[model samples]
Target: MTAIKAADSTDQAGVWITLRESSVPVRAILAGVLVNQLGGFLQIFLVLFLTERGFSAVQAGLALGCYGAGSFAGVLVGGAFSDRLGPRSAAFASMAGFAGLLIAVLYLRDFPLLLTAITLAGLVGRFYRPAAAALLSELTPQHRQVMIFAVYRLAINLGTTAAPLLGTLLISVSYELLFWVDAITALTYGVIALLTLPKQAKRPARPDAAGRRAGGYRAVLVDRRYVLFLLATFVQCCVYIQYVSTLPLAMKAAGLAMLWYSVAISLNGFIVITSELLVTKITQRLPIKLIVVVGFALLALGQLMYALPWGVGVFLVGTMIWTIAEIAAGPTMFSYPGRVAPDALRGRYIASQQTMFNLGAAVGPVVGVAVFRAVGAQLWLWCALATMLGLGLALLGMQEPDTALARRAAAATPVELTKDPA
Candidate 1:
């Protein structure tokens, strides 16, 4: 009995090690980081770019919203393609389409053309995400999937972290040059993706497998579980978007230094990177739903604190608290839908969720500005805090999915897992 027990423990250790060593997920994540970094640099100046082109505040917002609309569309399109043609082909197509749009932007001066270019570029550019998620899902195992996803998220933020400083220096040169540089990077990404990503794996047909169309975006939209997941996800986004859209403006209004504003946002990303590993460890002992609820509670408290009469020091303290919650909630929320999705439809389900996220992104700025104007920034923060708390309470009773369900769904037939692409 003692020898048998030793053999079982040894086998489990070997399996865990092998899961960690899988290279395919790592490569997909790396490629995604490279592309996102280049795009993020361009994004750092997106509003300024529009203003330079003579767009009014409303127009600029509309253009940005249009970009989000395109992103929403792109997820559906890319997810469908990923299911049919596989991740490699879908990712290549998304990149190529995005590159063409970027080139078109250079020649367009008309507002309509500019709007169209922005929309098209956003739609095509972000299409890589869903396909990339699908690819990562295929390569990653069930138990460690959240950790891999967290690492991918970290990569995205890390890539973007340097963008602001780079943009500030380059704006002195030419914003037009910025556009050209972004375009070049995007094209290069496509070329690398075409050259480096392996062909999709092929497997024998499974008895329970369903058609790709059955896993379409519309199907996922109507599912109650998916809808509930979307609600929780939207609240998370509402809290996070405050950092970019409102928090900076609020700080400036209070006469705080720009350096502190930068510090707050930078520290938020830093916290995320540091806490991701810690969060993964906790997920093993605590239910994911419970962790999610705690995350939301912390987020609410942080936002509410900001609304109070705090000095610059206290404001920074609140910012740190918010950062902690953001770090904990961000990856888990992103990973939740994938865990709940049907195996064959996981890509489509994820894309549908992405579409909802883009929807929130589109609405966040307009709604935030309106809230600030109508009731003051304090009210805006309080309302957001209340919403987060409300969401936490609503989600308190929801059950977490079991490990078997998540793994089986991830490994199901749409993904023909054969060799490690890493």
Candidate 2:
């Protein structure tokens, strides 16, 4: 089959064809990320690791918070690095840096030392994301954008689904073994980035403006619409993260067994892996805003399902609803910022999205758990309401990629240098 035709890609076969026809570099990214995420057990185990080492629950949680803080800041730094050093180098650096830190973290004994190391580990670990994502965006043709990201998300979900198992098995034996394995996979990706990504992966650090000019993130921040979209994204992430933290608490509080909670999570992961790409085959054809809005709506509805009488049936069914929402909307959410960004600013744009996700993740547990403690299951209702606001923001914020930027870029007249000559 030739490269996938946009019109023809509505079918499942066309989806496979698209994957087959993707450039080798793109495939390399998918492979590397799969390997990297396979050992991404650190996030799944950090709290456990700390607690086992005799840290108080509050201290463990604080260490986790430090990790989140590092990751939150890392994306912005990574975005800048990707623009300056190119995606391949940025990715390699992040992987290599993270690989070193992953093992280094195992040696620290004192709580203060552990906190500092974990924070750096988190920062360095996340540094590759913007570069990797920006590279993918550049490599992919816009028409195939969402589909490719769906495949990308599939790679992630596939690894994420299994990482916990590997983590569980290894943690049973030794944290040392788990940490070692995780480090190896990260280093492997660094090698892959260097070997697979050709020199063409470098984008101009400075993208020229046809009519007017701005600098660094100032160019990105001036666009009110994009900022609004980010606000919407931040809200959506807070609600989505509830499934990870608060949902379990709610399950336990409501006199439900943890088995049902685990099953519901596993179900979501399995369905997302199996069906996200298939769903994207259709969703990719829909308007970006429409898909995002529908996703938020469905997510809200899923939370409402939890608000119903708590039971195994409710748990399974609610998970299914949100799983559908994720498959349908997630690729578009991840891909849209890159699509709308100016090429030079692509890294920053994607980094911005990642930052929101991290920020939401950090805040979600704190806020969701607090609310859950206060009003109990009523937290679900609040999340649903917040989601509506996100939906509204998304509907308002999404617009066509500005044609003027491209037109100006093509004209190739250097009008102004908004940045300093360093």
Candidate 3:
């Protein structure tokens, strides 16, 4: 049994190694994910960015909420765009539009214009999400979906980890430079998508006995188990986002410098980027329910640690604890959408879950900051409680992954790669 387990591990590791080399679109998406995420400076710095410009904390929170709201709406529209326009056009539109609008926001000194630009930037920014996710899902087989999403998240974590430190350096020269770099990188990804992705992935779907499409948002909404999973996911994301939204504010309040917050969050990115793939390989071998429960619990526990004190020690240690939760559960959480959705509506399902993530992002800061003002550091306890609530829902709502059906669907559709112009 030991030998068999070790052999299984080797095969799993090998699969990830070959993933980047497997296909053109996969490689393009991976590169784009990394580049875009690395330059994803605006979201990380928006709160501070606005505060430095003399916007009140509440205003910054509202702007952050707008970004999240834009992302939420963008995902829904992105699903349709992904289906109708194909991955290439959808990604191009998202990236290119986001880049242009982002630059416009940086120039506008008027608060209302700034707020409007932020909202538009957020809206256009996430348009390619469903397309990229659908593309990855189409390329990967069912059993390996977790592995693919792990790689997908690796790009995101690596980029995010670097972004904070990188943004700090850019701001040393000019704050505008940071936004410019972000816009430029976004455009780079857009160009890559236009050149590499298939013109469209949408095609006719086979109707079921009901003479209607097999999947839609309506279908997703009616599914109780999945809806429950999304609810839990929202809370889990709320807990996770606190590190970004509230942690910095708390640290600043405690008289700790931004450097400390940067180091703490950078540590999280480093740990996840360095270890998540290995963690996923092992976790995928475990039962889904066990990981979900422990992961959510640890998330709450980590935040609970923050109730101790606001020193660097508490911050870093707490960050590490929740980062473990992320490693343990990230792959399952990401790939679960692909596992259950019908091929026709896969993008919509991915968007549905992602909307929950955005909902958490949208709501977390506004609520967190208000609570932080009301109760001070006791806010950490509230974060812990919220996570536990999510855990209970996850326990009841999430079901076994439909690996057989996913495997069968993946086999039935072989995606043809788009040839680059000579």
Candidate maximizing TM-score = 2
Q: Give all candidates' CA lDDT scores.
A: 0.67, 0.84, 0.83
Candidate 2 CA-lDDT value = 0.84
The predicted structure with the larger TM-score, 2 or 3, is: 2
State model 3's lDDT: 0.83
Q: Per-residue alpha-carbon lDDT of model 3 for 1-422, expressed as tens digits? A: 44345335634543456584567888899899999998888888999989998999999999998887787799998887776567788899999999998898788889889999999888888888888998888776655777888888888877876788898999999889999999999999999998888776646665766535535687778667789989998888877888878999988888898999999987887888888888887776666678898799889989998888647788889889999999999888998887777667778888888889878886888889899999999999999989989999998887556533555468657799999999
Poorly placed runs, candidate 2 (over 4 Å): 1-13, 47-61, 109-113, 200-213, 402-422
Collision pairs in model 1: 24-422, 343-409
Please count the clashing residue pairs in each candidate, in the order shown. 2, 1, 1
Report the lDDT tens digits of candidate 1 across residue range 1-422.
Answer: 44334323432222235336768545655655556574555455767777787778888888877886787788888777776677777777877777677667656778888889889887788777877777676666555566666667767776676667766777789876766777666776666666766676342354343443444666676566557777666656666577778777777877899898988877777777667656654443345665677777777777777676665775677778777776676666667666666655667877877876776666776677677767765754665565665475437523454643655456553765799889
Give candidate 1's error at residue 368 in angstroms: 3.6
CA lDDT, candidate 1, residue 360: 66
Least accurate stretch of 10 residues (summed lDDT) in model 1?
Answer: 6-15
- Model 3 TM-score, all chains together: 0.78
